[model samples]
Target: MQIVIVLSLLFIAIILFATEKISVDIVTLIMLIVLCTTRIITPEEAFAGFSSDFIVILASIFVLTAALEETGILEFMIARLVKIASRGANILLFLVMLISGTISAFMNNTTVTAMFVSPLMGVSRKLKFSASKILMPLAFASILGGTCTLIGTSTNVAVSGYIDKAGLAPVGMFEISGIGLIIFVVGMLYMMTIGRRLLPNHQDSALTEEYKMQKYITEVLVLPNSPLVNQLVYASDLSKKKFKMLNIIRGKEKFLPDYRTRIQANDILLVEGEIDDLITIRETKGIEIMADVVLEDALQSPDIRLAEILITAHSNLIRHTIREIDFQRRYGLTVLAVSRQGETLRTQISDVKLKLGDLLLVQGAQERLNYLRSNQHLAVLEEFSQVLFRKRKGIITISAFVLAIILGSFSVLPLSISFLGAAVISILTGCISTDRAYEAIDWRLLILIGGMTAFGAAMDKSGAAQFLANGIVDWLAPFGKISVLAGFIFLTVFLTQPMSNAAAALVIVPVALQTAAALDSNPRTFAIAVMLAASVSLVTPFEPSCILVYGPGKYRFSDFLKVGSGLTLILILIIIFMVPVFWPL
Candidate 1:
């Protein structure tokens, strides 16, 4: 009855996780409560998972990675890497995947992938290659790279801790490097050889080619007796059709037009959009395109173009509005637009206010741009060509991180202590500010992992794990331990397609352990197999890293399925063959 209840709760969690109707962390917490309340598991056992050393280690690693990011170290490394690659689609793809995978082995894969998204798109456009060809491979490489070390991903750490509790020694950092290396090589080779062929070429419709609004912007005259005279700009297609009024010049003064402002006679309107759209507005709305004056005529003498700037936590612009800071006079930049997550900006940027991590689209002279970036606060993303260097702090930050990994792997210190020490050292060395480090840690992921760990513990304590394992053991009795291990690996890989990789691993690990016990086999083997399988979730585009690159790559859902399914099949075979070799069942 406990097994049935646990299984039912597990099924419900999976459904909720996939549907995303509520947060995954909330769902896991609810599962824990249900198990404890129904006497399936004691409260003490249910809450024990939170105190697992694994969660501590995972949290420490997050802080360490955050420190590296705050120091601008990863950005510097990636910039140098992208610049060195030879100018060709195939070569660029190979270099990016290799570098991304290597970095992901140490850093958070999602953050590493996010750091490269914009730069990769810019590089693809400049080189005349399909962004789609490179992005999927990059995402896939990060996934494969997470297998290289125990600290490469949370799943590996969780599995190792669970195995340690089951009376086996925890796996070393490089212990699984052999299989991981093999998988990485195989995956990269497939991408360069076969995967490249499957990716759709979308060079023509690329963002750089299609979204260049510089040529479309022109000043237009709103003449007296025109049909558009005294009409609100919002009432016309200007608002509905996405036409932007850059500025309005009247007599000796010029103003950036507001959406609600009404058009007046002889008003010189600086408008930007496609030529066809501008022509349609001119003809139908009785506005005349100003052919004589350039864009600088209505604004300051210096010309400006829209640029998207990512507001770092350290940025001076945080919480301050354009009016409050006198942004134009103080920073010599005008915030024309801002976008946060998926929302678009409709109000005047200055009046809309600012927040940490907001992506702002600003207009300013190209020369003073670096001033805006270097304030140690804002991360200007428009200039992907320039390499960011933390030359002074790089050696120190890298040394601290390496020392932590070395100490943890050698058992000189627990992973939690090693990483925590490294994070402290980083802050002490001034490589990263304390506040920035705090902000960089992914609290959402930590919460999710913590909650799910508690749920996994409950399942184990309730005899639910043993019951489920007995069923699997009976089902696979005709087959050998190898078949049973392969079954667990395949189950994890399949579940990861629709759900998160960490959640999938958590759900499978207990059952896999139970099955091993039922067969009188080593649970460590099953644990390791499940961990590797969970990390190689390439069969779908739902992963955060994959989604970040999806639209930029112009890839369809079918594209990921077509290429990633093949990769997933190859990885499954590799795991089956390698698991017994390294960790005999």
Candidate 2:
């Protein structure tokens, strides 16, 4: 009955995770509550995961990664790499994949992809290649690289911690290096050969390409007999249409119009609307359309510039309509259009609720845009040139990180303490602020990891893990132990598509351990296999790193299937052959 109840809860949780109706962290918390309320696990056991050493290590890594980014070291290093990789397209792709993979082995792959997006765009322009050709490969390389180290991904740390609790030897830091390096090579070669051809060439449809607001904007002269003459701007017929009154030009003077501002005869109105609407207004509303209008003519000043800004997940503007936020009044910028999910939204944009991953084309003064850097709301994608570098602080923080790694490797300090000390040094040296350190840690991911770890304990307590493992072993016992190991790897890889890598690994680790014990095989080998498998087999854009590049790459869902499927299959075979060889399952 306990096994049945636990299995039922696990089934429901898996459905919720895949459906994404509720957040993953919430689902995990629910599972913990159910387990505790059912007396499957005590309250102490349910909450124990939050105090685990792995959680501390994971949080410290987040702070350390943020400090490295803040110091401009990553930008400085990537810029130098781009210069050297400027030889040709293929070489550039290869070098970028290698660099991105190496960095992702240390930092989060999502962060790595975000850092490289603008640089790779610069590379695309310089080499006359398309971003679509490179971005998918860049995201995939980062995923592959996460397989290289225990600290490389949350999945590795979670699985290692689980094994340690099971009384098996913990995973070494560089234990996966041998297989991981080979898998990276295989992925790189695949992208260079077949994956390159499968990728789209989106050079012509760059985000800036669609930012041509000149054609969409028009100047109209209010005729002497116009009904809107001497009418309040808010009460005018122009408000009924989709046209937005940007500014009013009367003779030599210009003014930005508001609701109370009145229009007069012969007053030139700079209106932003569709071309068809502008033509219709001229024919029906006693307005004269000006020919040969330029973007400069609509705005009075030459100081204002147009650029693309991405709404990050941390942005305050999310869930609010553009007009509700009074975006023009608050930021002193005019939004031209919004790009999201590979579609350019030009009409009804004012009513569209902003979401993360939306790209907004905005025209504003350089000073106002400069203020955006400190806003922490929107990222100005155009201005990648201005990088902040604190050389002394960067050197100190980097040295601290290396020392932490050394102490951890030599067993002089626990991995968590070493990294936590490094993070403290980074903050003390002013490499990153306390607030920035807090912002850098993914609280949702931490919650999910913590809550799910308790679920692992619940499964163990309820005998659900043993029951499932016995079933799997009974079914696969006809095959060799190696075949059973391969089955677990495949199961983990498939599960990651529906859940996070760490969640998938944690869910599978307990079962894999039970199965290994039943078969008299090394449980640590199965644990490590589950961890690495979770990192690979990323055959969809559901992964955060892949989602970051999806829009920039201008890729279809099929593109990942075409390219990532082959790579995932290759890596599976590699893991199946490599795992037993290393741990002798």
Candidate 3:
């Protein structure tokens, strides 16, 4: 009965995770409640994972990494890459992967990817190459870099914490670094060669053509006899008809229209609206449509520029429509279009509610666009300036982080204490503020990790892990222990598509450990295999690092399947064959 109950809950959890109707953290918390209610785990046991030392280590790393980012040190490094990339496209691709991969070994892959995305976009635009050519590779390198160390990814730390609780030695900071580096090198090579050809060549087209908005914006001259003359631009017939008054030209004066700006006879107005509505307005409102217009001329001026803003998961703008956002009043930009997955929506874009990974094509003054860079609400994928660096504080943050790593590596202090102390030092040195530090941590990911750790305990407590392991062993024992390990690694890779890498790894670890024990194989070998496998599940853009590039790269879902599928298979083969050599089965 206990096994049945646990299996039922596990089945339900997988479905909920895949459907994504509710947040993953909420699903995890709800699962905990159900387990506690059934007495599968006591309240103390259910919540114990949150209090583990790893939670501290994980949270501290978030702060330390954020401090480094806030110092603009990462941007400074990327700025140098841009200068070097000017020589050639191949050099640009190679340098981006190399630098981003190295940094990801020490920091969160998502943050590392985010730091590089805008700069690469700018680089690709200037070089006149397809952003699709490099963005996917950039994301892949950051992810592969995380396999190099225990602290490289949350999945590694979570698995280490779980194994430690199971009475095995926790993974050393660099214990897996040997095999990890091999994987990173292979992945980098694959992305550079075969994966390069598989990558789509979606050119960086102009915002108007890319968003399908060329037909939506045009100029109309206000006739002398029009009743709309002398009316405020914001209150005119055009505004009532949902036409966005972008710019107004009266005589020789041309400027962005304001609420107070009144229309005058013979004034030429640049407007954005549906083509059908625009045509009707000309007949009904006494305006003359201009001759064939250029999109750049109608939308941009000396003061106005075009850019894309990525809606991050942490962004407060998610779930809110552009109409509700008041982009003009708040960020001083107009929402011209929204891109999600691979589709672009230009019509009714203002009414579309934003979601994680949505790319917004906007038009605004350069200054206002730069302000979006400092705003935590949106990731502006445009001009990045390294002028915000704090040289002294940046050096201090680096010193503190290195000192922490050394102290922890040598066992001079507990790893958690070393990192936490460094995080505090970063704050004291003004590398990052207390509030920004709090925001830096991915609370949902932490919650999922902490809560799912308890679920692992429940699986053990209910003997669900044993039951599943027995079944797997029965099916694969004939082929040998090596086959069993391969089975678990493949399962983890598949599971990571819908669930987070950390969450997927946590779910599979217990079962793999139980299977190892049943077959009298090395449990540590199995545990490490499952952990590494989770990080290499690059068959889709479900990973956060991948999602950050999904829209910006103009990549289709098929693009990942076409490019990442081959690379994921190659990495899996490397892990499967390499694991036994490192730690014999």
Candidate 4:
């Protein structure tokens, strides 16, 4: 009955994750609640995941990474590297991926990708090559690089903590570096040689057309007899119809409207709304829709700026639509459109709930965008100025990261404590504020990892791991130990598409450990394989790193399928044969 209950919950969790109707962290917590209520796991067993040492290590890394970001260290370093490598497209791309990949091995993959996206976009324009060419390789390299270190990704730390709890030897800092280096090299080589040819060559287009914002935004000349004339801009007919009045052009002056600003005769109002309704306004008394409006001329002025602002995983505005947040009033920036993956929302963009990695095509004053970058956890892609660049702060932040790694690697301090200490130093030394430090941690990811860790305990407690292990061992017993390891690797990579890398690996590790025990093979071999397999999921753009690039690179679903599917296969082949030799299956 307990096994049935756990299995049923697992089935439901997989479906919920695939549908994505609810957030993954919420789904994981709901599963834990069910498990505890059913008495399948004690409160301690269900909650043990939250108290794990790996959780500390994971949270500390977020804080440390954000400290570096706040100090403008990583972005500054990347821009310098890009400038130095701008001699040729081939050499430029190689260095971009190499530096990004190496940084991602220590930093969060998403952060590394975010740091590089803006600069690379600029670089691609300078080289006259498609961003699709370099961005995809950058995303892939970051994911592959994380496989090279125990701290390279949260998946490694979580799996290490789980196996230790299961009574296996703890993973050393550099234990998997050899196999990880092999995976990185193969992934890089494949990306440069075969995968490079598969990338799309979508040329950079105008910001308005790139995000499909021109469908809604346009210019209209207000006639002298218009009902809107002499009315407050905030209370005009356009406002009632939900047409966002972005700017007012009278004579030669271009100004963003406010409550004090009133509609006047012959004023050209720059507005965004449903395209058909905006065009229909020509028939309305006293409105003339301007034909063949060049959006660049309407939107850009001496002080007006257009750029892409990314909603980060830690953004406070996640799940809130543009209207709900009063985004314009708060940030003084108009939302021209929001791009998710390859789909750009131009119609009713206000109703589209924001998600992590969604890019907002915004038009605002230069000062306003700069203020947003300083105050918010958002990235402005076309204009990412390193406003917080302080020489001393940068050195201190980098030293904290280095000291933590060195201390933990040499056993001077436990891994978790060493990272925690670094996080504290970042806070104390004025690198990042206390509130920002807390906000920098991706609490959703931490919850997903922590709650799913408990789910692994439930899988063990309910005998589900043993049951699955028995089936695998029975089926693959004749095929030998390598075959059983391969079975688990296949399961892990499949699960990663709909699930996060850490959650997928956590779900599979227990079953793999049980299978290894049944086969009397080295459990470490199977554990390491699952960990590496979790990061090898290039078959889809579902990975956070890939999602970050999807819209900006203008890649299609088939682009990832054609290029990443082949890379995933190659890496899996490396894992199936190479992991056993490293850990001795």
Off by over 4 Å in 1: 204-265, 268-302, 306-388
Find the candidate with the highest TM-score and give its number: 4
- Per-residue CA lDDT of model 2 for 1-585, tens digit only, reads 889889898889888999877878889888888888889999999888888898998999989888887898887888888788878888889999999999888777777777777777677777878778988999899988888887888888888877887788777788898888998899999999988887877664433355556777778889999998988875678877767777788998776665568999999988888888777776866788885355554564555566677775445686789999999878877787887767788888999988666778777677878777545456676535537767788788788888988898788999999999999999998999999999888788889988888888888989999999999999998898988999999999999888888998998999999999999998888988888899887688888778767766677788788888888988999998898888888
The residue-by-residue lDDT of candidate 3 on 34-142, one tens digit each, is 9999999999999899999899999999999889878877778889888988788999999999998988888898888877878788888888889899999999999
List, residue by residue over 1-585, the lDDT tens digit for candidate 4: 999999999889889988989998899999999999999999999889899999999999999998998898877798688888778889977887888889888989988987888778877777788889999999999988898888999999999999989999778888989998998888888888999888899988888777666666778899999888999987899988988888899998998886678899999998877767766776898888885355676788889988888886567888888889988888888887888887877778888889878989888998898787665468777634556677798899899899999999999999999999999998999999999999888888889999998999999989998999999999988988888888889999999987888989999999999998888889999999999999998988998889889888888899999999988988898999999888997
Give the alpha-carbon lDDT of every model.
0.74, 0.82, 0.87, 0.87
- What lDDT is reached at residue 44 by model 3? 98
Q: TM per model?
A: 0.79, 0.87, 0.94, 0.96
Backbone clashes in each candidate structure, one number apiece? 2, 0, 0, 0
Ranking of candidates on lDDT, top first: 3, 4, 2, 1
- Cα miss at 511, model 3 (Å)? 0.9
Predicted candidate 1 versus true structure: per-residue lDDT over 105-133, tens digit per residue: 88778767767766776777678677788
Predicted structure 3: lDDT: 0.87
Per-residue error (Å), model 2, residue 294: 9.6
> Against the correct fold, how does model 3 do in TM-score?
0.94
Among all windows of 10 consecutive residues in model 1, the one with the lowest summed lDDT is 204-213
